[model samples]
Target: MRRPFEQLPRSLSPLPGEDLHGFVLRLAHRLDLTPIVLLRHTGLIDPHRHSAPARRMFMLEKDELAAFCTTTGMSPQDAQALTFKPHVDSYPPVATALLGLRGLSPAPRGVFPVWLLTTSTRYCPSCLAGDGSAIQQRHGGPWKVVWRLAATFACPEHRSFLHTTCPACGLPAQRIRGRSRSLMVEPHTDPLHPSRCRNVTDPEQGPCGARLDSAHLTDNDNPSDDLLNLQHRLLRARPYGTSSALDSLAGHNRMTDLFVLAALIRATWPLTADLAPSPSLARALDHDIGRPGPAPSLRISATAQKRWDSDVFSARGTAALLAISARILNLPLPELRLELRRVIAAMPPLDDAAWGQTWLNLRRDSSPLFRHEVLQLLDQRFPRPLPTHVALPGFLLIRRRSYSPKAIPQFLPEEWAEIITAPLGHTSGRSPGKTAIRRGLAAHLIQAVTGMSLDDAGTYLGIPPAWMAAWGRFRPLEERLHGCRADLSVLFQRLTDHVADQRAVDYAARRKRFANWTLPESDLQRIVENYPGRRRLLARGSQRGARMRVGFSALVWSQLTGSEWRLAPDLQPLPVEGVAMVDAGVIHQLQGRNPDHQPFYTYLHDLLPDYASTVLEGEDHQ
Candidate 1:
């Protein structure tokens, strides 16, 4: 590690160009190496600033090469490998060459086709140290001088070209640590967190079950410096075990933006705050920021902060920020993992506009959709856009979002408590929205299907019966639904046992209330009673239909040809969703009207895919 990098001769055999500058540039094209790596071994194409137009042309050419590789299914690493051949035999010479331009031979031969990797450093024009000098000067010496090379750029002769010192190590002209790689690589967030392992007891450390990374620091005014190193990173702050989203929202704007990504990992994710926890962060806040932890936790007269829970420092931002926080917070595995998961979940589901830009940026290769579970999620979120729907139900069936409120606790530090208040409610509670009315209607609809008293379904879905009844009358759609009776035993058991098809039975049960199926309390008692083969009723077509069904559903529509069908519980019909639950006595009535129509299938055909209703629990044991 102490050896000069100049001795590291670049092998250009399989690559396309030759000559020092040309070879380094070609090696850059071939190896996709960073300029600092290149400069350590060689030097700049122009020792001085070339015309801006000339530099633009060079950049344009580089951009074109990248585009070509991306369009052809080549990753940055693949491109490097396709053109690189790391030299095992000529290693010493390359190492010497990497020690900087001073150690090279003028009559260099054989080195033309040498194996080489490249990296680059930028220098501050003022004092030749680096643009970081002014920032480093403020932090003083301890963090300023990191690399010996960064110091050399400001050595007397070149001092005038440098600006300020380094922020981390404070040395003039020193390069900050850039990633070291061979051939080519994609600079992704490291994916080696220990939490991903199968250890049963969660680790006491960070989410990855190990120490977290350091957060990168940026000058509030110079956003350009932050973006300068991104080199093809995805914009979406995706978490580990997942790909990223390169959206414009993540673009550098000097905003010091804070985000909280909460994943309901394992059992529950505690509610964490979204501000930096350090006293330094508090010291950094503007006067208007109040308590300086999070905007929501401010102790101003706002009632929300008193009962608030949530940790300070949102879990996202530049790799630098994430790295820094990971290092500083020393978060335990559970907390870190939850934070990572939240980041994953909080990431807006990628849309065509956002994902497309990334695909295009990547040269339109496969469009990053190969991940199976993701492809399915794509279908669920945009059934029409992804061009596939059958796979979606399975995807959504795997992760239902409802968990207890336990996650709220996990978010805040143990010392903090949650402050909850009715967001806009006042003491008088006057002027309510139509939301209440719609909710009432939804309640009334449920009672029709489960044959629950207004009180029963209220208990399940968590609304009171009186409010539910009033809401029902308020919303017209929930007022007119009914279903034929279902034996209560069969409901808690298998729908197929009492009804013809399980899908139809479940569908009927779910919809009875919405359809306004009259369920006298007697229906519940009937199924609760001894098995009655046929407790006769007045009969169909009587003033009060005898064999009345009960259930509420929005699953009926007439096609141009007049065909109709029942919808699966997901509200869409998959072959797995094909079950028939018909009025045991009335199957004969609709026979000729629809051929493939099992009374169950009849309602199902019209079913819409309600992706939120299910999760794949790995095949029903039932």
Candidate 2:
């Protein structure tokens, strides 16, 4: 635990559950906890508060404490093995009071002391490790903590400082992190060690907008500042650098620079004037069929390729070239392309159109850290939309890398508006405010355009993804069977050794595969597969033949849900719910006493005279 939080730059950024630790530390300092403690308490450490050393590290809510001990199967008596004293002498009145100071408020004013533990210098010796926190607000269960760093009282540290690596051409944040790291370095890189790459120029709190000079490089031809270089370096280190071999990711070493590598890549572009992928990038990949990664042979989804082209090479442009050489060391071009594929795969799975539009946003020169010329060029080619999806991952990615959240607006084409209604990822609890807004609006638009019910509109607007996980948890494996029989059959044959023998693979493969199957047979085959047995699977027959069709699979749920339930934006059926109600429309699609039925609100009007105020029109009407 590094003390005087300012000394360590790495301790500043937050880890998943560590935000609480940092908050307490910063708060303690801010509240002048040291003064009262210096006079009254020996140290903040309480010998009686926790039974174990680890338990003492974090602050838990009252209920949480009970749960923790219960979950861990330690009786309160055994748990009493730790200390419980507040050590109020070392903490300020506010700090002490917040932590159950006896004389102040009747109840402890603060939430769990998770912030201080998370920010402890002991864990990381870089920067203060705290999530973005708002000033003390009224206490409620739903408070959100922001994760960006902020400057207090004319931060001198805000100014950019020269470091060994260039932000543009450096290894991913996961690899060689020290402290004071960029907000948007590649994920799975390093937990940022802030000052390690402190800004050379800054007003504090945002992008420094520095211009490139030859001095940024150590040796002009070096590729030591990049991720690929680091990986290769670790490769040379054997068991020491191996995954299980090393205790921590940072224990490994590397010196590649990605920026210069990109420069080399661009210079060799248009390989042989073909306008195809460059040879230098191609040779880097190791896609020899069953290899760890695909070879120089490009097989990443077109959509993924488009996103990649927009993110790294195309969007970042010449500026990105600065970091490429440092990242990729001994690899050839094909391997590098394969590396790009890996990066794309690692990134969250968002739609291609959204990714493209976000890329189009990169062309703007809204900030000096990026190339305005490129943004201009992109604008000329892929004009902005009327209104864009505000909660895009691209925005988050850019903000972190550019070191300025505001830079996102500049990169955004005129079309994209800030999503104020809901946040991007409610599940993670990170994204908040205005994310669901767009989907909600789309539902309305579909209603107007297709004359579909609000429920149907929302369903149409939010269909299950074809192959990957989508927003809703519902799985649509069945529909996929018919639509992609050839692909599925090929995959099954390759895996099952033709054990689930497919006599025919056709559009009606689902029907054909299950043609001769009697009722109550091949349940596993029915699931985990579709058209491979299409002759049998898709063979729709009477109730007796199909054995009383029961629970409609997610494919049917996806279609029916959108067609029926997404009638309005106000209600959204989250991923997991145990019940399904069936009504007349559903009966027409599948002949069964299906459960997903709910009375249309229209009847309530007649049942209750004052229904005008309580019962909505379309809702009550059958």
Candidate 3:
């Protein structure tokens, strides 16, 4: 069992926005003790453990933080603010939920995401030199929490890029190697300055205790204003104020978009060369592009290559990539698609498969707006013969803010068929079967728009998947459609325009309003008197008469709603008897036009507009 911690006789006040690891170092330095001793004394780390705590040291558990507060006389809120917990929502990389963990528990195997700078941090020398306060002068200065984020590259206050490694020893500052058992470098070393380099040069030579805050140690290179601005925007707690394009996105989504865009920019390097904001950036990009491999041997392992691909550690490389990504993200939808196409066109022919992989990754990782743009580009590039897995274009899948599947009937309506078939233009009798093509087109549209499997969409539409599959085997629909791309494009545009302008009919609305409605018996009786020849066939007061009435009612319902006769209410229960009667009635009306019901369809279509208007006007009076 653990013992309660007692208040420390001497301790430094916690600095604002300082990380937990940095606080531990500063407190240890103030008391002339090593970080490991301080941690053990506070009961934050187990004194008996042989290995470094296998979780991120910055993320503390509730009890651990309570113990630290109890021992140091600090408030719980102040101690809690030291961890990345508050920023998790705005910063995705620090979100442990992404790693499938809960609360402040460390990740298994210490395997954090590469996007987080858990093992090392970038630092500005001037910030580490303190603010001339007595306490700061004694302990150097606060090591900030934001410097641990890979997205943060430059120090806005100092107007320079953060140094990645110690200038004296050439090792990443405060890095905890595999052999170490604590967060601090040289954990047991005493009498060492908190701002000095403590990384061991040799087992015999001890630690390289070089001052990190000295003026001579700072890097001479100055950062561009644009880079500094980008860094400032990224570091702001609320990023919505940065730009209009970013204001529309939530904090998490905005950061996600930026990260995804950066990934894409890096994945296709020189192809995105023209997107760089400055010549220096373009030259840096060219240098990386020229030498594809990092080592002199011209070979790179997959892990190393992945690291290089997501290289946020290098200040110049990350700045160049992120600057280009931000510019691209700020583009409007049409230009965004065009820019993606331009980059894709510049890709090497041999890397077609690579581009495909990148697209798949984008599909998984991109924000909704970015995903929509990619989908639009995909629709234009591969307009026809799309894979079953791919989603159809948004225009094809939706209209008037409603799902297309609900609006489309099982069979193509006569007016829609005319619009689609008008473009084929007498293909010398070589055109596919008109009935098969129309039905196939309906099924294909449903499948593509809903992103369902071929079999699933067919089943949903009451068409057998095997039948459509067999038809495609005999004469692939794609081959025929591919030849008429130009005509089809124009035809599609015409259909879009027609649908937009047509206000006389809303089949989906009619279907919903009349889902359970049937023609009144008074109207049916009056209509029966006109058809004396079929009067006995539709006689009332018998089982046969009841089925006949239901069948005819279904016919009227189908006509009014523009749905397939098979989809009318109460038809599913009497599939055999009801359907037979409905079929006979249709044939009687068509008069030997077995497959063409245009005459009857035209009569109903011509009558519907006035009937709908009368019904609505009467309802308004009521």
Candidate 4:
């Protein structure tokens, strides 16, 4: 279907890591020709373009590539190895998302998949300098496809992080030089062609036409050998399998997948905010073996936001994430398991529906251990066949009566010190460390003073209340009761005073309303509309009918009053006994009649207004 190139004047041998575009540019420079002429001679022009070819040189079709290789004295295998096409085809997730097709979709020509890869190029100065050592290598540096990977922060050979932009001019490395006519003012038309350095402030004099390979590594920049080793291992290692069984998470787009999992873990851990080490492990994410790369910048992604996930990581951040993940993965299996369990256990309980929905996406994951750990957590929290019998209501009252003490036990100063200092053996892996023991002890003391049950208090204060119960057995009964009541009387007195003062206010408000008693228009409207049959009785101006006007419905008022108040033909009549003055007791009784309002009376003492004011203020304020 396609033919080879007609002929060529000259061609250079393909360099290692050289992409198709780089190879083409290098060949053209060798022949003293422009990239446009070289591409045209090889039949690589985009058919739809009006001026110069619009398509990038990297977006070469198979036929166009064959023609170019045939003319350049290069092999098809060499071309495939250097290009990004093969790498994109091999990664299924990238292909599916970027290409919008799966399984049988061949990559279409001239369609640049920017989503799958970054357009910004990065290069290693040391490697570039190595390429410049020989006179023949001056045209271009040996650029690797791996250099384009966002995760590949460090250069394996150089042991230093790759540079994306020029430190002097802030111009990004590998930027196309010949995009517009203005950019073409100096030496080239194709922006893909790198020109001399454009930075005027660069101390190195001359036209700034220095090769990118000649860039220098600063003396203070320390290189990481461990990161370099890891990078090489990642490049050489296969995804599906490795010698260590712990390495099974490796798969297609393994680096990206690993970074995603780490982010997911960070999101799911609830207490990570509080338990996070001072300054966060995230701050030091890029510090690989003492060498730090650029600071990580996490940007929110629209797609992830729709799914309610964290912001997407920048390329440098992704590299840091990968570095962090690599360190985590390198830990021994037991240690890793322990750390994971700690994280899961530290999360506060979530509701069934929410937890299930959050975990649903991760359920079908390929990694058995990861899936098992998460599922096992859910299983432990809400096991199958939930308990049917509800706990007894008024548990505190029941406990007080059942365990009424003739004498309660208390601890001595020495024993109290021991309880405060000693560990309460196996506190659900959530035990506070020695550094936080004082805070933890204070929480436990507060719990004990409040009379909280063992399990609830233990979980809250991170101290075993059950253990305290056992310790109390050895103390004297009188001492224990004394300790329990020592700080309670003042609190109880304040609470009683507060309730009495509130009741007095309620009474005063009621008396004022009674003094100005009149059936408001709103109350009349409600009664008339609700009981249309009683309208005639209301309009009759009967003495009994006027008293029927009350805040509550007839049913509730009648139920509260019983034999105290009578009903006329209107259904509810005003009280005859307390005609002149309003009764606050009647209002209270009316409010208490509703089932929803019943709970408010549980803590209040039943006292009349006159007596309540005397008890609250030492004597009546009026």
| TM-score of every model versus the real structure | 0.19, 0.19, 0.56, 0.44
TM-score of 3: 0.56
Model 2 local distance difference test score? 0.25
Q: Let me know the TM-score candidate 1 reaches against the reference structure.
A: 0.19
Model 1, residue 418: distance off in Å is 30
**lDDT, candidate 3, 1-622, per-residue tens:** 7776888899878787787777888998889887778878776777774323625354667677777888998887788677665566566566532322212223333444445666567777788888899988999887888877777767788787777778888877776665333455666777577778877878798887878877363343467787787777776523223544443125555666676656556666767777786777677655644545331111222334432224444565566777787777777767877787775454333223332323333443345566666556556656553333322222122211223555555565556655766565423221336555555555545553565544555565655444567544113333444434323323544554554454545555666766776655655455455453434334566665555455556666666666555566746543543357555565244333345554433443344455445555664477
lDDT of 4 by residue, 382-485 (tens): 45422212111111111011121111111111222233233222132212242133322323232333434334433433233433443332122212223131
Lowest lDDT sum, 10 consecutive residues, model 4, at 392-401
| lDDT by residue (tens digit), candidate 2, 142-184 | 1011111100001112121112223543421112122211112
User: Cα RMSDs of all predictions?
Assistant: 24.7, 23.9, 11.6, 25.3
Q: On lDDT, who's better, 2 or 4? A: 4
After superposition, candidate 2 runs with Cα above 4 Å error: 1-160, 163-622
* Ranked by lDDT, top first: 3, 4, 2, 1
Clashing pairs in 4: 176-191, 177-191, 178-190, 178-191, 408-477, 409-477, 409-480, 410-480
2 or 4, greater by TM-score: 4
Where does candidate 3 clash, by residue pair?
Answer: none
- lDDT values for all models: 0.25, 0.25, 0.58, 0.39
Question: Whole-model lDDT for model 4 versus the true structure?
Answer: 0.39
Where in model 4 is the C-alpha error above 4 Å?
1-4, 47-60, 86-101, 104-116, 130-136, 176-211, 237-250, 253-256, 265-319, 332-622
